[model samples]
Each structure stands twice: as C-alpha cells, then as structure tokens.
Target: MARTRQPEVSNDVTRLITQIRAMIGKGEELPPERLLADQLKVKRHRLRLALETMRDAAELPRPIIRRNDSPVLKSDVVVQGTNALEVIELRIVLEPAIARLAAVRASPVQIAKILEAATTPQGVTRTIGDIAFHKLLADSSGNQLAASLYAFLRRVGSDHRLHVPTASAITSERIQQRDQEHRAIAEAIAARSPDAAEQAMRQHLRRVQREIADRLNPLETA
Candidate 1:
C-alpha cells in the first residue's frame, strides 16, 4: 500500500503562524490586521486567513468580549473588573483537583519544570511561563479530563490577564511568599502526598483570590 502524503502548509501561512506563535508565547499582545500584515511580511488577506486557520486549529484561543461583543480592551477599567471576578471563579473550580493528580503522577522532569517556572527570576513575570507550568502540572497528573479542564481554565486566565492589570503591586516579599507556596506544592507532589499537595495549592489560590478581591473591592480590604 502506498503511503498518503500529508497536506503541506503554504510557506506564507507557516511563516505567519510562526510569528503569531512567537508573539503569543512571549505574552505579547498582537496588533490588528494591518500591523500583523506588515510584521509577517504577508498580505492583509493572507494574514487574516492564517489567523483564522490557526484559531480554527485551536492554536489561537478565542477572544473574550463584553456584553456588547466589543473585544475587551487591556487597559479598560471595566474589562479589569470583569477579569477580576472571572479569575477567582476559575481558580476555585480547577486547581485543587489538578494538584491532587500532580502529586500522584508527575515525573521528576515535569516536577522540575514546574519548580523552575515558579522560581525563575524574570524582570517581568511572564503569564505564559506560569501557564505553561500549570499545563505541565496537569499533564503530569495523568488524568486526561483534568488536563483538558486545566487547559480551558488556563485560556480563561490568559484572557483575563490580557484584559486586566496583573500583579503590578507584587513586591519582593509577595514574590517570595508565592515562591514558598509553590515550593510546598512541588515538595508535596515529589513526596507523592496527594492530600498535602491539594491542600497547599488550595491555600495558595485562596490567598491569591483574596488579594485580587481586595484590590477589586477596597471596602472588603478595609
């Protein structure tokens, strides 16, 4: 029997997707059609087609919008408010289970990647890097359903960050605190203690949720 050849992607489309992936991987916001066309050295139509294909293939996630269907603007106060609420809801539903599975199934290499992502000293905290870590943790959990759910939750988190201010108020002390929490989670996983890992992760997420809520509702903070 003859082997069937795979469909080849056009050079232009491939190049455009590469550029788009690079921008997304670095957590950079993409510009609109005209700017993307210029950056990718392609026609506007080609760029649009490439983007559409990538989105359809799930390489690019869908945009989150407001009630009127306007794309959420990153600097808009209303978008930030919406994001603050959404992130809290997502974390409460996702992290505990992921942590439990990670404790049972994460291999040494996967655990190391999670620890490195959590501990890295980058000038700007990269949301992509953090997300990659979480995804890896989910994969390591050896549960397909948990992994899929984590992926969805991560997209929501990414959209929220894109439309909202991140922890601009993150101080050195706060970073250290986060690092410690991550370490505790990692250690519990390494020890194969599912209960401990889940508890640690839940505690960390609750702390993060409270901080974000406090920022969103200063009256709560008071």
Candidate 2:
C-alpha cells in the first residue's frame, strides 16, 4: 500500500493551530482573522479552513454568530443564565486581585486613563462610567488572560436584565457613593499602592453586594 499525502490545507491548519496556541500561552487574545492570516502568511481561505478544523476538534469555544455576524463567546450564554449576585460574588473574588496587579503594573498612561474613567461625566449614565473604570483597571493588570476574563464578567454584570430586580436601589446617593469608591480605587492604583488598591476594590465590591442583598431580601419577603 502507498502512503497517502495530506492536503496542503492540513499543514496550514496545523501551523495556524500552533501559532494560536502560542498566543494563548502568552495570555494574548487571538488577533482578527485577516490580520492573523497576514501574519501567518496564509491565505484567508486557509485561515477559515484552519478555524473550521479547530472548531470541529472542539479546540475552540463554539461561537454564536450575532445578526452582524460577530462571534460571541459560548461562555456568554452561561453568564447570561446566571443571576447578578452570582456575577458580583465572582467579581468580589477577581477584581481585588486585578486592582492589586494594576497598582503594581500599570503604566503612567494607563494610570491616567484609569483616573479619567473614574469620573462620571455629566449627562452620562454612571453605569457606563463605572464599567469603563473597572475595565481600565482590568486592562492595566498586565495579564491579558485576566483582562479578557474580566471583560466577560463585565458584560454579564452590566446586562440590564440581570439587575432589573435591584434597579430601584441604584439611587443618586448610591451612584455618588459608587463613584467615590471608583475614585478611591483609581487613586490607589495611581499611587502604586497595591495594598490600598486591593482593599479599596474589595470594599467597593462588598458594598455593592450588600446593597443588592438588601434589595433582594425585601423582594423575597414581598
């Protein structure tokens, strides 16, 4: 029997997989397909074949295509199924560490961005500012994996549907307090005080948890 030769695409797919694995190991997000194909010196069609191979092998998370043909992560569905409290509890565990790392690792430019994000602009929803502030901290953590994970967490946490039950609890006073907490965390990171950053982040999350719990308990009683 003669040995069979694999198609050229098989080799290209293997190369693509190897490169993607390297990027993952380095805690970097996969680049856009066109840019990645260019970088790998592979044709777009070959890149698509490589992606299909990975997907078939269950090597990649199944992507849900939106109306715009954007791929949303499978984990997003799981997050959407979970309640807000669960999301906040996870944030309590993850964000303090992120803030600590940001304090230690954030560049001056990142610090400035963090500070800017900390303040909610007039006529803008505080929720948007809050998300931006925390996201900046995550991005500043100098760990791309952590940053990516936080982005997922943020998306779920910010989903209005998840927080509808506690929406009434978000008063002007509470928003002010939350903004103050954001500022505190930003200041700690700006000062490069890891301990302070960690503590501030923990305190802020705990306060949010408490408020949500207070609201939920009343609803349950009713």
Candidate 3:
C-alpha cells in the first residue's frame, strides 16, 4: 500500500494565527470568517476548519458572544500609546522580581526553553511571541508568585495592544534589545546569579520605562 499524506491542518492553523497576529499588530479590527477566508484565500469551510484547529491548539479562545450587527467605533476607548506606556510601567515593577525568582527556581529544561524562545526566529513576531516567551519564562521559574505576576503582566500587555496606537512600534532593533536583555537575565539565572539577574532585568525595565515616559511626557524633563 502507498503511504498517505496527512492533511496540513497544523500548517493551516499556524497560518491563521499568524494572519490574526499581523492584523492585531496593525491595530485592525477584523471580521471573523470573512477576514480569515479573504486573508487565507481559502473557502469558508477551510477557514472554519483552520479556526477550529487554532482553538484546539489554544492559539485562540472560543468566541463567547456572536453578533450580527455592524462594527461600532469605540470613541471612549483610551488611546493605545498611553495604554502601552502604562503596561511598560507596570512591568518595570513586576518582571525584575520574576527574573530573580526564575534564577533561583528554573529547571535546566525550562531555562533552555526560555532562552530558545527569546532567541528564536519566531521571536520576530514581536509582541505576541515576546509575550508568549515571557509567559514560558515565568512558568519555568517554578515560583507561584512569579507565575501570577507574569500572568498579570501578559494581560496588561494584551490590553495595551488593544488600546495603544503605537504598540506595534516594536522593530527588529527593539526586539534585538529586548532579546539581549532577556538573554542577560537568562544567563545570570543559568549561572545562579539571582541578584545579578534581578538587577539586569530591573535596569532594562527602567530604561524601557524612561523611553516610554519620554515619548508620553516629553515636556516633563524641561
């Protein structure tokens, strides 16, 4: 008997997820099926199949509510740039401590995973991949306190993306900077330098905070 090829279901799901992430990066509010079908250039049925696959993979959550109405512009929504600044500020207070704990608690496998995620080509996905990498780092840290804080930080990052216009301003250079900072923390952790990791992480976050503050309140220093 001839060998049969498996359906590329996983590839389809990954494609869908990438498209959705790209749309989110551009701050576009996409319609569900039509957007998927149009972007993926697949039939509605295939699009639905891809969506289901993604949902199963936990790349997307099942929709809680469906609407037949037209999209409404939310004028009351806060500007996204400001929201991103708030998220960065919150992380400045939270992630350094997580880094410290991760240094003390992470297993070798978990540490390797964290480093791999931070240094991977997929890390170019910017906000989405970066957030996922940080979540994995927190989980690897094996500290409940750090895990909870990481979850909170992830939520804040998500909310910031939704509300902040310039959130996708993450560039290759910026990603490189973030990757280096994360690598420094990870290396310190691997070396059992908890205090050094914490300090490096804190310093990186402080620089981020300062950059955000400069953009948000440029007149403050004058």
TM-scores of the candidates in the order shown? 0.58, 0.63, 0.56
Residue-wise C-alpha lDDT for candidate 2, range 3-106, written one tens digit per residue: 88755556657888888755533334467889988988888988888887765544443344446755466555876579878988999999999999999988
TM-score of 2: 0.63
lDDT of each: 0.69, 0.77, 0.65
The digit string of per-residue lDDT tens for model 3 on 1-222 reads 998875666676567667765653343435778866876687788678766765554434355453655434232243333476666777877787788887887776667656666653552466665666666556655565556556655554566353434434667787788888878877888887889988988888887777766666657854
Task: Point to the candidate with the largest lDDT.
Answer: 2
Descending-TM-score candidate ranking: 2, 1, 3
Ordering by lDDT:
2, 1, 3
* Model 2 misplaced stretches (Cα beyond 4 Å): 1-73, 167-170, 219-222
Candidate 1's residue-wise lDDT over 91-151, tens digit each?
7677878889888777676676566656634654744545555665676776766676676
Better of 1 and 2 by TM-score: 2
Better of 1 and 3 by lDDT: 1
